[model samples]
Target: MKYIKKYHKYIGLFGCLLIAISCFLPFIKYSILNINETNNFFNGDGKLVLAINIITILLILFNKDKTSLISTVSIVVILIQNILTINKDIISIGKLGYIHFSIGFYLLIAGIVICIVYPFLPKEKNIS
Candidate 1:
């Protein structure tokens, strides 16, 4: 816990970096009519998510309470929006392969989870 508290900011920064990198990786994959298709951050609202993540990185660096809260809320909203739309947009056809969330999607969720949890971690104790 002590180590986490001391390095929470860096952890958050790492999460933000993961998010930024994930933006360029394949996010979703599905097959329709025997053809496979993959989508990345640039295809949908990914660019917006990336932009918000950049703001989150700045907020984490600044270490402002209110700003962090705002960024967390915004990230949650984006996550929810993506979850809802991904389900809605993918049309399931009989005999077609199932939709799969690729590496980028998981990485994105992981990063968001880290960011959301960082603010709640206990503060470091003073040894002196």
Candidate 2:
């Protein structure tokens, strides 16, 4: 807990970085069509996720106050919503091919989780 608090800002930054990168990676793939495409600009909700990550990054860089914490929580909510929506879309495509969630999806989840959790950690102890 102490370690996490001590480097909370950096941890958040890393999560933001992950979210940013995930936007460019393959979020989902249609095995039948061999479509291993990136999310974000092309398809899916990666663009919004990336946008939120950028906002979170700015908040983390500029302030560690309640607003930043609130934004992180909001981002997590948005991320989860996107996930569910995508799942629903996938189901709607039923039998279109073997749908496989690629690394980007997992990474985004991990990143959002990290971003949300760090805000609630106990403050670091001052050694000075």
Against the hidden true structure, what lDDT does model 2 obtain?
A: 0.70
Q: Which model scores highest in TM-score?
A: 1
Q: Candidate 2: where is the Cα deviation over 4 Å?
A: 33-42, 125-128
Runs off by more than 4 Å, candidate 1: 91-95, 124-128
TM-score list, all predictions: 0.84, 0.74
What is residue 8's positional error in candidate 2, in angstroms? 2.0
CA error at residue 68 for candidate 2, angstroms: 2.4
Residue 38 Cα positional deviation in candidate 1, in Å, after optimal superposition? 0.8
TM-score of 2: 0.74
Colliding residue pairs in candidate 1: none
Candidate 2, 77-124: lDDT as tens digits: 776787687688678877765666788778777877777766666666
